[model samples]
Target: MDLIGALPRLAARRPPVLLVTMPGATRERLAVEAELTGRDWPSAPGPAAAAGLVVAGRAGGAQWLGDLWNGMPRPRAYVAVAHAGDAPHALDLLGRLLSSGREGDAPRAVSAGAPRGAPGQGGGDGPDHHPGAPGSGARETPGDEDGRSGRGGQEGRNGRGQARGQGRGQGQGRKQGRALGLGQGRGQEQGQEQEQGERGQEQERGQEQERGQERGQGQERGQGQGHGGHRGGVAGLPMAGRADDRDGLRLDRLHLPLGPALADWPAGLVLDVALQGDVLQSAEAHPWEAAPAGRYPFWGEPWLRAAGGEAVTRGAAERRRCASHLDSVGRFLAVSGWPRPAARARRLRDRLLQGAAAGELAPEVLRLTRGVARSRTLRWLTRGLGELPAGRARELGVTGPALAADGDVHARLRVWLGEIERSVHGMDDPRALTGVDGPRGRLDGPRPPSRLLLAALLPLLPGAEFACARLILASFDPDPDEFVGAGHG
Candidate 1:
């Protein structure tokens, strides 16, 4: 029936793709997302389900990239799009690779039982082993490390192996008990101490059963110690240390580094946090490594050029400001568990960037901003979260919408809506932009406003739940591009 040949063709029809964005590559990311949306291809939720990976932007020396690539299942394809203009071609290449059943020069798939620390698997003696780390000996499941849906076959095999070992141990115990019974029978025939001999044999059989159980348990433990050894941790990762949580209760605190690659998160930003059961105990923001010197930050380009004595019109700056807010709104909505509005927001952002006139975009923009504003459900979800009062924000050198909102997550959202509405109306303004303020904040500061935004996160995130923490970060929506080629704060 030629079924083997047909398999690739069938799988290629709509292969789920994982989209990765590098820092300073928002334009590339937007282009790739637009292409994928047009094709109606589904996005892979995690490495386990990805059939192809499309990295949008240059492949910098990020260690997580290698780890994620190695964790995906076999028969996969990969392509990197360094420029926005190259997204379509990169995707076409991905499709061809998937349909041709060729993996090209990617590393060989590591066996489920292979030790993670082995050569070329990307594992080492360092504590860099996370769930999806290359050769970390950990299974890459969807969502969390403890999840179990992705690797069912390997788990089943291990389960069956344990069962067989237990069965063999019991069988040996039975044989040993039978031999003791025969000896006891011979002793009974020799003397009148038959009762005592039978009691001794019964005790021996009980002891033998205990030994059999011990052997079975030992075998199970050995099987469980895949590559990590028995250090009392999952998947060879170190055990989480215990700490006193906010409520004065001791809990296990797991150290997790978020971002630099997470979806809807700021590119090139990494937040290292110690969490005690989803409650962040502490957080530290790692300074983003600057990109090459000549590349300008995308959203703040107009203002930056204006500051450099270039003639930039107010209308162009306003258009960029609106688009920037739309982008942030899209990310915030997506992270808030509202994907439909998020997609609409991105569509509007793309239209604005493509030079749509104010008359054409005003109605759609108003519709989206109003829809998000009037959503009581979204308001309820975000209200009273990530509170940064105006005084506190001023104290931290914060400005812009964060200072304007001066309240909580909902307040920041309101500020964005207001700014977006105002900017939309000013898209036709022809006056020269005298001010050096960009979408995020003033561009003439000693440090970028985003740096102050990043600083604010240190105080706001610790008391919030994990999901709330993400929402708070989205509310701030610090653009990593602003930090490119700039000194650390």
Candidate 2:
């Protein structure tokens, strides 16, 4: 490689990998613990900082994924892992790609120039389609002689024009009096006045026609689309309505969608959020997909398989449970900004999945649980966030640790810890499993346990600050695969 080409490769000496989780692909835990340096986007400063993306799951769609791939700077690479066992191999390939220089291998979307500063490339939508970007608001309006819409800009222009017109009018009248010989020009002045009057009427007629055209277009757009047309606000969002805010100021509420690709967030889950400043005003939970086809819901696999009449050993179930709890803990820690502990939790999870014996893994689990649970700081930060009332939990169909913890994130952590401790002891059981006691909750019904948790979580986020809302969500750490019936965690 030339000096310019080799620079990117040299810069990638242990570059961070961006992990992209897909539905039913539970191999992300392995990738995160695979000794490969990993970084997250949107939260990782910018798109150009990472070496490559490690996608751990099936690649169903292309457009959104392409945009995400394109948004990265040149010399980027991507590798997909089909299963947990594939992570090491994918990481190895990623390392090779990064070391050798990814310039030639960059995705086609990048060479074509993809949208930047967009969330996951803002999907298949056109440029500036993402939230907070100037969208269709740039369209020229008939009423806008100065290329701006709304009353304020036009009024400002009109006011300035009127001032200029007044000055010009006074000057013209004096000039006409001087041209006709001051005192003898009364009739001439009258004639000039009549001409001026006619001209003013013509100008007014023209202005009225333009105004009428603008109104007609605006009306058509309102009938064809909504208030701001298909492309709304300055950012192309439907114009937000004003509501009383915390400081008693009327503020515009923005509906932002999070996830489906966010780091440490559930795969295939999208939360539509109504935000006022940094506070969540309202939120709704929806999934990008239901249970994915042809994969076991990774987190609840052992119990689910057992429910389906397959013989699953109690030891296997216990291992899954232990790993599942560890995964959740890792995500919670990551969201809490405790990356070191989060990495440790993921490492422990990977070891359990690798078939480590309970005797060997017990100490690490103890250290993690003890260190995390005893952290007065973590508890203080997370306590009382997203508290779910017991009655409401049942009403919303939430069970498991969320319900057990009285719906508080702090209490939920404790439940997870207790479950992990119990799971370690049961890891040696040799009997066949028959019930549906999965990590998230019972998997007896057609619905996934995470769905209930998601539903319950949406309602709780509305009034919380952004950071607290994220922490609260991380506490639940609902896995999408559990609902999809594909991939056991």
Candidate 3:
């Protein structure tokens, strides 16, 4: 029936894509996301599930990109869209490549090894199987330096020892026969006794080796239980260290970095965190790159241009501000585990960016915002999270909605909703722009507002759980493009 051959073609109709966004590539990312949504093609959450890799914008010398591509299952496709306008063509090419079913059309993997089975197959030890991932089984014990099993090596050593023992016994018997001139029977008896002793010693040594191997296996099992039911380290990586948690109890602290390639994550924003039992002990924010000097940050462009005496219209600035909030709202919703509202927010944002008039977007925007604002469940989930008093924010040189919210995650969300409503109504204003404040913060600050946002994270993340930490970052939603060429660290 050739069902196996036909599977690739069937799956190619709408292959899942793993989209990677590089630093300073928000415009291209948005374009790619919008295109994917239009086609009803699903987005793959990770490389393990992806049938293709779609990178929006340049690779920016990110070495991890190649690793991610190699980790995906074979018969995969890849495309890089350097410009927002190129997203459609790039994705179209990806689809064609996936459907072609020709090995030569597939993107070359970084590793020369044959393609591995899908994740969870092959004893759940495939390249994409992360030991820490939920439901992953125990990790296979690492082999010795020469790639030989410990048991096999131990047996080989034991065999050689037995051979040496026999040779020595034979030599002793012959020497006794020649030197002492003992009877042949006596010499043979002595030789047999010597050989038996040697064999007994070898048996004892083999037993000790087996016991040692058992102890090692037991220790590994204990370590796996202490961690996530998998070995602590993989690929020669070191194991996590122990540290006192918030409750004063010592626990394993894993240093994990949430990345530059995660889905719904900010472009180029990397949060290096030390986590103990799902709670963050500390977090450091590193902006990978910044917009080049004289290049405007995408979300803050209107305000920055207006501040530069470009004579931008107030209506245009308001529209940009509205779109910015929508974008942030979408990311927050997605991270909060609400996909439908997140998709809706993104659609609204795209419509605004496409120059849709206020009259056409106001109704939908109002409905989305109202729904999000009135959800008790949402409020309950976010209330008392990422709290930052107005006084504290001002002390940190923070501005914009973060300062205005003056409370928790819920407060920040409310501020965004309020500003979105206000801006949507003002999108038609004809007056020239007068304020230098951008969607994020004041453009005239000594440093970029996003830098302040990044700095604020160091303090806010330490006491929060890992999930709450992600929400806090999403609420802040610092645009990395603002740091470009700004010598950010």
Model 3 lDDT at residue 21: 75
Count clashes in each candidate, considering only residues at least 3 apart in sequence or on different chains: 0, 14, 3
Compared with the true structure, all predictions reach lDDT values of 0.67, 0.60, 0.67
Off by over 4 Å in 1: 103-232, 236-238, 485-489
User: Per-residue CA lDDT of candidate 3, range 224-282, in tens?
Assistant: 54345122333322247888988889888866555656666677666656778667888
Total colliding residue pairs, candidate 3: 3
Q: What residue pairs are clashing in model 1?
A: none
TM accuracy, model 1: 0.74
Instruction: Evaluate model 1: give its lDDT.
Output: 0.67
Candidate 2 residue-wise lDDT, 279-345, digit = tens? 8888777655543476677778788788778999999999998989998998888777787898788
lDDT of 2: 0.60
Give the TM-score comparing model 2 with the true structure, all chains together.
0.71
